[model samples]
Target: MNIVACVKQVPDTEAQIKVKPDGSGIEEGGIKWVMNPYDEFGVEEALRLKEKNGGEVTIVCVGPARAMETIRTALAMGADKGIHISDPAFDGADAYTTASALAAAIKGIPHDIVFCGQRAIDDDSAQVGAVLAELLEIPQVTVVTKLEFAGNSVKVIRPIEGAQLLIECPFPCVVTAQKGLNEPRYASLPGIMKAKKKPVDVKDAGALGVSTDRKARVVRFVPPPARAAGKIICADDTPEGKAAELAKLLREEAKVI
Candidate 1:
């Protein structure tokens, strides 16, 4: 199996997010970054499939130069190689442009399967995987929690509202892995050393014929309003007084009563 998994670098989930002074975009200072967590499932699943079939797994990510760190992490975890498609134009490109860039990169490689996270952590756009499949004109599944190989076909189990649906599809398909699909393993010390020797391919969006600078641009960014402080009144507090206070705040202050 030649599995191509798409990964990404995102602001660390624990990092503090702040907008620029003029609200043009993220402050981009004093922020730590890491691999998109959801993408870990896709990487793990690809590695597992390679172990079973004795094939190759390649990871792809698009971001700034620092994004290579995220790719290196995957290589340490056992991917054969990685490709980074990035440029300044990609800084604020929307999901459509991003997907186009990915498809262009994938078009240059022949693989039996493509794996991706159900959604990116930063944008949470579940659009890329599905859009890339459409551009590639291949069968694809999303929100897949379980996968099994059977002869020439593969069976996928996807969670529904309260249950799951088991669907079978042929090989050479795309799948967006969901969380809990598998536990991601840590790279051993030796593996980390080996990753340094792994090959990394870097390409820009222009090389892929997809311009990162699109018609849309980030005009500004503003943080959400701060949460209001909460107050705790003793259970014995007067119910009438509490109700009256809530009414006054909702009606007079909130103005949405």
Candidate 2:
């Protein structure tokens, strides 16, 4: 079983993020980068699969040079090798373009199963894995919380609003892992040292033969407006009067009634 796990680099959730004054993107100067949390679940699942089936787990990533750090992070957690897809042409790429590059790399490799996070925490698009599956012409299961392996097929459980759906798909399929899939393991000291020696094949868009055309693009990024201070309703002496004042404020000032 040759398992391919796709990972992405994203800013730490706790990092202080500030938008560029030009409304272009976030300020990356002091941001701490890490592997996307959901993607970590995918990597952990891949490692578990490799452990059970006795095969190699390859980490595939699409990002700039800094993304190699994330790939090595996966390696430290027991992935065998990594493929880093990086290029200037891929800058500002949309989900379609991103998935295209991933599909191109996967096409050249032996992949019996492919795993990806349900969505990248940065963009929250939740489209790359499904798009990659479509480009590969293989079956795909998204938002998967549980997985079970059979002879040549895999069963997955995905949750809906109030119920869960159990789906079965064959090998050579794509699965987007959800949060409940599994707990991610931290890399040991020995594993961290070994990861530094692991081989990572860096490929460009041209090398992958993927087009740079973007089906969608982010024109601009604007920071959310600063929240306003809450108003105190202490003007009214009675509780009923305070409730009436609150309703009036909601209907007039807040306009949320």
Candidate 3:
């Protein structure tokens, strides 16, 4: 099955994110990082595919040195090895640049199937898998909920607005996993220990021979405005009066009506 799963490290969903005063980026200090939830499904699916077809699963990630933890997390979950792309040039890189780095790394490996999350939690840009597929000149299927092997090809189910589409794609294809795909397994004690010794090939932008030019960049990151406090309508003397007052407030002050 020679599967390749692309993953990312992101701030925990429960973590309180603070934007920098300069609006360049968020404050990394005191922030807890974890593997993207959507990518976990892709890793789980890759592990399952390897267990069934008898091959290895490789994890590919692009981030700073801290991202090695995310690759190790996937390794602890049963991936065979990892490729960590860490370089200063990739800082604040857009989806196209990130996908370019991933494609460069995967180009040197044996991959029959490439798995990625439908969208990264940090960026929420569901473009990497498709971009990588295009760069690799291979087919792609996005937001896949269910997948089944069919000899040299695979069948996948993708949900739309109100309906679903069943697609059959050949080998050497990219698949973006959706939430309903599968449940991710926790790393066991033995797996965790083994992951510490697993091989991880670290590469830089130069090693991958990828250009640093970005298709787009984040100019600034601004925090949302604070919410206003709620108002009470306790001045009304009776229930009917309160109702009338509320209506008046809605229609005049709030102007919602």
- Each prediction's whole-model lDDT (CA): 0.86, 0.94, 0.94
Candidate 3, 1-257: lDDT as tens digits: 78999999998988888899999999999989999999999999999998998899999999999999999999999999999999989988899999999999999999899999999888788999999999989999999999998878899999999999999999999999999999999999999999999999999999899997898988999898888988878755799988999999999998999
Off by over 4 Å in 3: 232-257
Q: Please provide, for model 2 over 1-257, each residue's C-alpha lDDT reduced to its tens digit, 9 standing for 90 to 100.
A: 99999999999999887889998888999899999999999999999988998899999999999999999999999999999999978887899999999999999999999999999989889999999999999999999999998868899999999999999999999999999999999999999999999999999988988898999978889888878888889756799999999999999988998
TM-score for every candidate vs. truth? 0.88, 0.91, 0.91
Tens-digit per-residue lDDT, 1-257, candidate 1: 77899998988899888888888888778889888887889999999988998789989898899999889899999999989987887887777788888888888887788998999878777888998888888889889989897766679999989898999978788899998889988988888899999998889866788766565455767899898897653344799877877777779877997
The residue ranges of model 2 lying beyond 4 angstroms of the native Cα positions read 233-257
State candidate 2's TM-score: 0.91
RMSD of each: 3.5, 2.4, 2.5
What is the alpha-carbon RMSD of candidate 1 to the true structure?
3.5
Q: What is the lDDT of residue 169 in candidate 2?
A: 95
